[model samples]
Target chain A: MDAIDCDVHCAPDSYEALFPHLSEYWRQYITEAGIRVNGLAHAYPRGVGATAPSTYEALADRVLDRRGVRFVILNCLTGFETHRNAYFGAAVASAINDWVREEFLARDEGLRASLVVSTISPEDAVAEIERVGEDRRFVQVLLPVRSDLPWGHKNNHAVFAAARERGLQVALHAWGRAGKAPTPSGFTTTYLEDYVGNQSIAQGQVLSFVSEGVFERFPDLRVVLIECGFAWLPPLLWRFDKDWKGVWREVPWLGRRPSEYVREHFRATTAPAHLPRDPVLLDQLLEMLDGPGMLTYASDYPHEHGDGLAGLLDRLGEEQRRSVMWSTAAELYGLAGNPAASSRA
Target chain B: MSHVEVRSGGAPVTKRGVELVDCDVHAQATEPMLAQYLSAPARRLLERYGRRTPRVTEWYPRARNAGMRVDAWPGKPGHIWGSDPELMRAQLLDEFGIDYAVLEVLSGQDCYDHPDFAAEWNHAINQWQLEEWLSFDPRLRGTIAVPHEYPALAVAEIERRAGDERFVAVLLPASAAEQLGSPKYWPIYEAAAAYGRPVAFHTGGYVDHRGPGYPSYYLEYHVGNGIVMQSQLASMVAGGMFEAVPGLRVVLTECGVAWAAALQWSLDAAWELMRDDHPRLERRPSEYIREHVWFTTQPIEEPDDPKQLVWAIEQAGIGERLLFATDYPHWDFDSPKQALPRVMDASLRRAILCENALELYGLPRERAVP
Candidate 1:
């Protein structure tokens, strides 16, 4: 099967790896400040096998060749999205984008990358998107799923506008902003809670996007949720559609059912399948979720979410499997019929 | 007017031969009613603020009739919707042949910044429910409303009401200052468990209600009910609170049901990958959830295709744990007849509508159709 791996992660080998990409001032600022990117330690921990490839050869060896994926979208999260200092965050984000381009995209024919942006400042995010979004190899703009404010807030609209203007889809990958509490209540006491809470945060973002009129404003925008599970979508959308009927007047800009907008606008990576162990129930869930239309295949390489994918694949029909594994993401990222695009770039 | 004649429009709900137990029926508390029970200092605060304290601002304005059904208002000019117990009995208990209606009084007192005031106000609300609503009807039951932020006071309130059979559970807001499973809240759980009353976390609180921040619209806030519930559930499972208080049982009310199955899967899968993160957990995360938690089906997920709902319930693997609720008087009330899918199995329907709640709350199984 020719699969499009929608979410494969990469990171700088070390802080020094980003030095050449960063401006001289930022390089000095980081070194003098003794700053470090903790690799989103709260989420990825230290030794639970969530190590991302620091180079293109490693990613290709691990995901492309081993997994036989036709294409892989490289998501390089430098942990700068949650950085407290806005200016420093912006500089680090720019460096991460450059590093992703020069190291990953420039090396492999099967590689495409997401432009890293500082979520703290929409103006800087837009500037970063405009700078690298024009690169055809850069197919989407990457934002962390966890943010100080939801991406749908009007304040962040410019970042979406910039991505859409440059014909880039937005990918909200899981694990972000360690400084911020993972749950609505407050901080979690364990990593298990913080990690599982990512899906809940993803749910919040989806509601934010639909209810805050982000979809209405950017009709053509497509947002893919990477590393976040998709099985939860059916129920969330069901509630969303029902509540919108009762409260549509509050968000008057919406012209259709919230589920309809979500179905049209959103796609989710299938790494953390979050599927029932029962085959019958898994089939039922896929049917409820319109799996063929909404799910995109991803290895979420180096993050060891269990072997639920085999069960998901077994439950899917041949055509539906093809759609989930390849076509849905191809259409979502405009990679269909463009086999040579990555090579040419 | 006869009880059956005044039912809000829908097919007859009590046709099935099972008892109907509404797990979530709101009994709105008015300022004057609650102030009557408070101490002088708290009473003065209540009188001065009039239930609209700076801490309890309505950031997410509900869409219709202040989040209540227009017809739910009592005929009296100044009476609030769902305030008059006779009207509630006529509309909900008698109308639908409900054997037991567990009253959830969201007094807005829990959000008070002043701990002393919050504790006093919540205590007053509990007293108000006992005298004004629960005592008014034989079918009604009470929840011990608590100032959850101040766990010591919450524990005290639970202990004070421990002997009351009319009060079936302890009520805590789903959104709180910290996740309900934290050590700070263990004392409240201890008190509730000591008395054999399950703690019910209903949706609504002063917390921002989203991990990110306040959402732009009430629709988002409405959708956030499930999100916050999932967070709390994950917190409880991971914080080892279930291990800390083995007798603790939780009922998540008015937070949609379908998300539970998905959260279970996510928790189990993540626990597999990250088991070492929390060495305190003796079993898989889902095990604790299945053993300890119950869910209420109010504002039930009504998918476009009813069969999809059947699939969701099956996926949730919690038919025995499902508790049926109407969220009566709220604008998005789920009618007993139409809330669930018609395609559901007869046995499952029995469990959801009556048997499950009976097992959870230890209510009498006799059909009390007035």
Candidate 2:
């Protein structure tokens, strides 16, 4: 069975790579400010070999051809989501979207891209989503996990609404704004804390989405947590379901258990899999998580998380393996007519 | 100690013949009650403000009865839940057959911006707990509430209470202005270790409880408790707090347990990638966690499949480290009789419910049931 990589990261080599896509005003602004895309440098430090493919050809060579995946979704995180200035953020988001389209999606038939949006302003984010979301190749709207407020807040609901209207899923990728504290307490002193914090932050987002009734408002809206570990979900959902039972009146719109909403609406990319090394334990965890239904394959190229994927796959049944490796993501992105079937046709 | 009324008739212990230790039991204190233990200047300040300390704005509205179980409240007018020791003993200790219950008074005084005022408030809370609650019940123990933001003051508070055998742990908020593991707070850890009192990071505090600003509902805030605990655990592991104070033991109370295994795995992965960044004398993150940290199973993670919950516990490899707790008087209190999974091994169940806490708090194995 062919696999579908849900979170293959792509970025411009530098700010200069986006110059062609950017307006002259932003071009000059970026140049003058000496703005460079750090790309989770704190979390995925340079010395640890955390580089992404800067071009489609490079990505194709590195992941597509090597991994033998049927489809790969390109998530372009150019540090635009962290911009403080709304206008600058919007422009950069637009440029990154445009750059991903022309430089990656337009070049590869198998490639689909996530629409980059400015998280600083909901209106701007919605506009960006609406503008670029018309393209069938753009399967999801990409938002950074780190934000001034959670994505489920009513103020930010429009972004999700816009994506839903455009038939685009929202993908919250790990390692968002560096300015925001990784933890609720405050800034983390080391890279390890900041890195592990992605999973923690993802849990908060899941709670926010469920508690704020984001699913109730947009019943069909789906979310994918990319690079955020999936192992934490079962426990988080357990807690969520338990807490919601006591406080369901507060969020009366939630007609069902929070876990039910999550199971129906959410999918997570399996990269940097935080699974137990013991196969028996891993299998038990998978059973608890309903992993086949929730997880999709993602190489998270150039980021080394050891051989967790192999261990995870070895623990799963053939059907469950196929679901995680291909069908789940294929169904999620609505990737109809597999190339294998189409080629024969 | 002042004489307090006791109900001679109380509910029978449910877990008959089983050793039970409750790791978390809040002994609530009202403003006027805490004021009695405060210094003259602090008492005047309390009167001037009409409250013991400035209330930190709780952005999200809590559940009914201010997140307290309605039944746990004393029937008397103006009395709060867990305020009357006799009521708590009837409802929690005697009723549940809890051999030892660690008393934590979450006064929210530690969140006070004024260092001096915060210290005074925490000191008052400690005194009140000792005199009123601890002295009232032989089954009860104390957790020293300190102004954790001010380490020197926190160290002094720990030292002052170090001689008291009743105080089992030093209480710090899970959410704080800085990660509890930061070097700035190492002095507090050192003091806790020196006294052989484990540092317990309980759920609520002054710090924002969600990573992405504040949440919209109390449900979110409640769920964020686990997230905050994960972050603190990671911070402690990465900050080398265990290595800095090798004897220092940490306990995460009222935070969910199942997520710890995943967090440990993620930490181990990240440490492997960024080991060079932290060279403070070496060990895998999970090793340190397994060796040093303990988790209280209150508001325990109840997965649909009971077996799955057991698997999660086993995966965490901290079965011996699990301390059972019933967050008494809270709306979502876990009952000692029904909390642990029936599927869990008898030995592990005993370890979580009684033995682990007995060893951690250095309590006697054979305490007479009151």
In candidate 2, how many clashes are counted? Answer: 0
- Model 1 segments more than 4 A misplaced: A79-82, A336-345, B1-18, B49-57, B367-370
Model 1 chain B: ten consecutive residues of lowest lDDT: B1-10
Local accuracy of candidate 2 as per-residue lDDT tens digits, B19-54: 889998888888888888778987887788654333
Candidate 1: RMSD over Cα atoms? 4.6
User: lDDT, candidate 1, residue A31?
Assistant: 82
Q: Report the Cα RMSD per candidate.
A: 4.6, 4.5
Q: DockQ, in order, for the candidates?
A: 0.72, 0.72
* Reference-based TM-score, model 2: 0.94
Residue B165, candidate 1: alpha-carbon lDDT: 91
Off by over 4 Å in 2: A337-345, B1-18, B50-57, B108-110, B368-370
Q: What TM-score results for chain B when candidate 1 is compared with the true chain B?
A: 0.92
